[model samples]
Target chain A: MNDPNFQNDDLLDIHNLKTYFFTREGVVRAVDGVDFKVKVGEIFGLVGESGCGKSVTSLSILRLVNPPGRVVDGSILFQGRNLLELTDAEMRQVRGNRISMIFQQPLPSLDPIRPIGDQIVEALLVHKKMDQRQAWKHAVDLLNLVGIPDASRRSHSYPFELSGGMAQRAMIAIALSCEPELLIADEPTTALDVTIQAQILELLCDLRSRLGMAIILITHDLGVVAEMADWVSVMYAGRVVEEASVNSLFEEPLHPYTRGLIESIPVLDQDRKRLNAIPGVVCDCINMPAGCKFAPRCKVQIEKNMTICNKHEPHLLEVSPNHKVRCWLYEEFSH
Target chain B: MRHTQCNDGQSNLKESTNHILVEIHNLVKYFPVRSGLFQKITAYVKAVDGVSFNIKDGETLGLVGESGCGKTTVGRSILRLTRATSGEILYDGKDILKAKSSDLKSFRRNMQIIFQDPYSSLDPRLQIGESVGLPLYVHGMKNAKQRQEIVVAMLEKVGLKAQHLNHYPYEFSGGQLQRIGIARALTLNPKFIVCDEPVSALDVSIQAQILNLLSDLQEEFGLTYLFIAHNLSVVKHFSDRVAVMYLGKIIELADRDEIYKNHLHPYTQALMSAIPHPNPHRNRQKRIILTGDVPSPLNPPAGCHFHTRCPVVMDVCNQGEPEFKEMSPGHWVACWKVS
Candidate 1:
């Protein structure tokens, strides 16, 4: 089943991807020219605030964007093939079988009436050549793999019957049924409590190592990203503002937005009373600024008298090894 | 009211009073869950069961817990926003629940609440100025010109411009809207404020701004706060003392340092450990991953509420409920193993 020609370790390569929402007010540039690579068995974090297009970028990869929103430009190269070029049927074949996704709210996403086992078995039946009996048995095994105690009995319970944590575990079981190469977990732990969130993150980490599957963990919490992701691409107003290893991202954030976000989080370990918050809010996608989306709110840009920041949007410029920042302040560092 | 963020020594120097401003004794709130053909009240969701704590004047007391843990219920009960099932809520030596209707109106003027979702809390139809000045109108402020002036001044205190008075809730960002919420709370110049997850709805960039504003307001006005939030770090950062709640009960109550560093309760330990550390290297260590979901509060475990999922559960934990006791100086815990 392995394709030798599937290129380098980049399991998913998104290049200049643009997904826009055609609303009555204006064109909402949700995921504007987003570029990133998810390597084999790598945990790639997409970090951003709400409406910054982290979810849209993920949705675009799976071709899940509705008519109101469309993946207008660029390509999603998954397994050496441009996913955008694939037919609907071909894409469907690749979807659950190769790349499965688990959402934030597990109970709502799962069918209310059907037993979780039937739901999971349905996924297996649709993706694989398995009878109901075999699929049900396999579903229980998958549930067990996802750390659900009394898998067989629990599998027969409906979504409402299970608690939030257990429902999340059930969702993970369904996601892992086909054993996809890339698992897109979009805020999988956001709806959960702290303890439950930790469990889910641990499961994600454990499953990644055991199955050697690349993961795209989309989350707003930098702490969650820091704890789990090996590398991260910080998105601001529908653009990847910076890319760096998890350590560097936390230690020395190059982008002003990234720096502000990191500093903004309430300090856990230190005795710091005051937090250094960024001024202003997230840029609007519809009535976007002429230049850098963050320029108006960019303190460093104004401090440095970088008027160019307001005139032209800065492209992703590689400064350090394996680190890239999209800002006018770091222009001198770029080649 | 139009004072700038007094970050220069004055804000840091908290002139906190030692005497309790709010004394909640054995507070309990249970929501009725109806069922069957006749829709009879078959059970009760014990949202806040046997919770007790105190908030000192001009001091921020953080109440933290997971979802449905009754932290919010506790906050609401103190202000008499939601009627408690039992227990006494003493505000400045006067019981709030026993206060007459006419007296409670004045009591509400001294006590205000700022909700979580800044978007929904403020009316979208009303102008920002009207929303801010609404409380003044209700409290028998007659002059429109005077109300306008007060609203403008209050808005300025919260880092909003005089121009923003004309704009609606939709026009402002979540942070600015939250500022409006804070400004509204301060209009009556309340002595106490219940900040219910004020920054949870805002982005990380904006959360700090709101927190800074809240702290500044607290300092400038000498306002007491009962800060209720699900995020432990936010609570730790903002509060002087903290109370950790679990399944409608205050399992642990201590100073911020003690709660963060030397947490006594097993549930508290797990909750603390569950927080994803900002540093990648640190979170890889032993995180006390508790198994199973939080049991329904409608029919909590016969013994300890947390015994169902407690990692180090003993026979006593399952047999009888442990009494909440002060094990250390100002540190209270409700676990049999801790003592």
Candidate 2:
């Protein structure tokens, strides 16, 4: 699967990664047979609706899937080293030092009782052996870098005292305190209003250029993915149904699910009488169907006599140089 | 169904060029903030402060604003779900605010509301059928068998099966639950409905489904909607006219095309540019990112509430609030700069 010319450029690569929750009711395959790669300094968008396993895939990378949920199979290669094979101590060192994550809601992720400044300082102190005074100064600088006004004064305030945008800025400050190589932001601006959301998105793009860090942005909003991501992966059920550059994906989506998703969004400029919404809900994970997960909702499959779609699971095969899709419609095009 | 009689009475109501279903004039709703052990009234939150607009018959009026901007408060206040502090709410030429309890009870049948959070809005204890049919039973639909038949028909109208009637709320998905919510709102054959962020909580695909269903139902029933949402795109698609709200105030109100094409208010412009375009090829617009959070309604800025963050703030803007006046045929803006 490795191309010799572009091998080292890939920062994080996953091969058939599977994360499942073993509950008494049934084994829920959250992230099943997922595969994708993020290049250095590129923004890779992981998008899908709720319960589609986009979040689970990110948690699996950090080895942060809690008990009852486990990474059952597949390898997560980060910087050519398999993360799934790492020891707990090594993984801990890799967490804030190399790859940091920001959550959807920043308030609950932060400590309510502690000052926001102290939280950043604590992250710095734990990861690096630095003096308290120097660490505190660096924390203030980080806060200011994230565009927080009156950083020094605002730092002393508790998480509850800060607004939604301010709290998210604090979260970003903590994530960037270590100057990590990769930042995994899970719906970073979903809680924010549009104005603040744009501000946050701009700040992230600025930080990426200044710090030269790769980003894995996970969101359900396709508009956000289109604006920010260099490459996009459309997830369904628990697997990546399609992967392509942002331009190509939006211009001409190959996978049925990706096409439906893009068509489903209500565009701001266009006065579309009716949005072409995909019928039916996502597949049930515990009792998932045999073949293509999206077959039930695929209008293409229903139109053409694509009986193979239901009988056999399709692999993510390349149709173009950079575009890959997991659908039988492109089977003949795959080279 | 027995409720069909109510529609006959509504149809007799005069329909003319100046036919307005509901008109809100200088509505004010304030919740007092208590303090200390004595629980004295410290100040009022002023959730809905002096806002006025009219919903034309069989037209969808979009009420849009950022969170905590009193959009939801306006919808609730118009329904009298939360008693207004002051101002007149005229429903078909009758002041609902001045209506007696008996009158208000009957008027509620004509006006209904669909809440944002489908999960919390519904009662988990009751069956889905009972939940949808509760309004019918309360508003004098006696005969259990007749109510059940109407409930089944209503559920079918919202794209649910009759078998779903016996199921509990927990048994349905978020999209399905929203459909049930819409079913409940439509069961009364309401002439006007306040869809308060109805599609905000659902997924994108499901949101489109719900929006389509709403449009279809609107055409079928000749319903007037006050569609309240934070997402501008959805509102633009569904509403004939849109009103932009700031902290407890309507900063701009215009026809859908006028608001989108000739947005005059700075706040509205900022909001328009902030929407992330789904197409990547389009050159990104110069976004006006408003700095600072919305001020607390308790001690709101003295003059214009938006002056604190407006890019083109003037001395007069800080000293006095601008009057919301019609600049064009249908466009109304509350900004000194626009004039």
Candidate 3:
């Protein structure tokens, strides 16, 4: 991904991306000046809990931010080309051709009445400019690629006929119909059972390797991130709290938020008496405080072990060769 | 936190009668599928078939399975939320299935349910105060003013602000809403509550909050729970004993620690393996991918329902139904190979 022909070091470089939602009350800064880069053929996991602006960032990348929710700042650069500068038509070509996105729910995304075959073919016909017959054939091939059995017969089946796992496979097939360069999967397995969820994640990894496609997987599950992500970006209250390679992030997470998230996860090996949860809920995104978003619930800060967290929002500074953390503890430790 | 130590071990060798609070015997609930204008009974979809377990008083019994595995059905049947076609549900030495209407009302006071979706489970139009106190209103406990006071007390009990009582269900976050839901179930001072995927709807950060709240509330209230969820991790945390349901039957039921440490049932093993371990250092074996989907319960496969996908399936697994038997002291399994 960081190869010489990487075309300015990133497949997707989002600089100071800001997505705000205008409600009757006030503007909710769903995503506020977040920056990260995804390289070619690499899986960049955007990790965050609910209401942390991870989904908004992905939606902004595709210019799918609807009314009331608007990208108010910064640029989204892919392969040295700015997406914001492109026309709607150009962006249309970009979507499903160069970059495709698979949403969390498959049923709502798919037209219930229409057969899945036609819908998948639409992705091909619209993006690839393929003939009807060719698109249909390609659609079936894509379905097979995602491991949907009896692709030929299953193509004609409606979304309702397919199970949740199968419908998810159809969505994946549609996403990969045009063989996009990059895929943005938003909580692809959140609703699925562990068995089916594992299968889906495995399929994503397999697809990435086979197609040499870069992926930006947005999820809260640290296990999914660790398993698939080459690089991981931990988001908390509309900010990139930490960014590191998957190995580095897991081995030595610098940010307290990242550490908390990791520790909160029920580890299989340890016989934990109680979950070490970061006490207190996530801050309401609408009325964020001036200081670090995680300051209120931080144990170290409460103990006065990390005083800087309360006064200033630390920038994501490099703590290691490939790891970056935005935390006062890291700053003090490094100093 | 309410701390009542009750062992809900499956009935087996050295069976302790004291631990058994609710015993289900050969429970079967089948929905008749009809076709044509005449509505002829074509087949029966067995949602819960030959499922049995005993829940100890003041103990959390975790029932885990994939969607449509009859786990929810098991919970609903126990509470008589859904009428079971045939089964003996022995609750504290009384058969509730044969109880009268007025007796059922008394049974309802002891048993309650906390649904999965907090948004839908709580009425949108009602205030948190009225919603939590609705049972009191139905039972005619006190006037509106007194009911409001009790609701506020319950709200504070679940870690919600008393002021938030005036707010609608839409006002609170998912976790807080679940807390309200919990508060609603607890307002009646129930002995047992069926928690069906209570924390699954919440975010990971908030899940712990609700789980901790449930644990604390259980200890405080001396409550028993038939905790059903897809998340094995949370189940491990809250449950004293765990039951793994598949298709329409309980494949395995054992102590939480024993199940996690040494799972006997093939289905349980597969489910455990499938759980993505957050720790990257502990590289578990690639999940045992169960080949094929769960067979339609309308006409479940012959013999062992899991034989279609079981990796180590035997000849007998396809010929006859595997007997649900006690494999160890408290561990109960229904597999032919687990001698």
Q: Which pairs of residues clash in candidate 2, taking residues 3 or more apart in a chain or in different chains?
A: none
Q: Which candidate is the best by DockQ?
A: 1
Tens digits of per-residue lDDT for model 2 on B32-129? 99999999999999888899999888889999999999999899988888899999999999999999989997899989999899999899999999
Per-candidate TM-scores read 0.96, 0.97, 0.94
**Winner of 1 and 2 under lDDT:** 2
Tens-digit lDDT track of model 1 for A1-335: 44578768888899999999999998999999999999999999999999999999998999999989999999999988899999999999888889999999999999999999999999899999899899999999999999999998998999998989889999988888899999999999998889889988999999999999999999999989999999999999999999999988888888988888888888668887788989887777789999999998888887888889889999899988889999888888865
lDDT rank order? 2, 1, 3
Clashing pairs in 3: B2-B219, B2-B220, B3-B219
Superposed by TM-score, candidate 2 places the C-alpha of residue B279 at a distance from the truth, in angstroms, of 0.6
Question: What TM-score results for chain B in every one of the models?
Answer: 0.95, 0.96, 0.93
Residue A226 CA displacement from its true place in model 1, Å: 0.8
> In model 3, how large is the Cα lDDT of residue B37?
100
Q: How good is the docking of model 2, as DockQ? A: 0.77
Model 1 residue runs over 4 Å out of place are A1-4, B1-16, B37-39
Which lDDT tens digits does candidate 2 get at residues A14-72? 99999999999899999999999888999999999999999999999999999899999
Give fnat (model 2): 0.73
Better of 1 and 3 by TM-score: 1
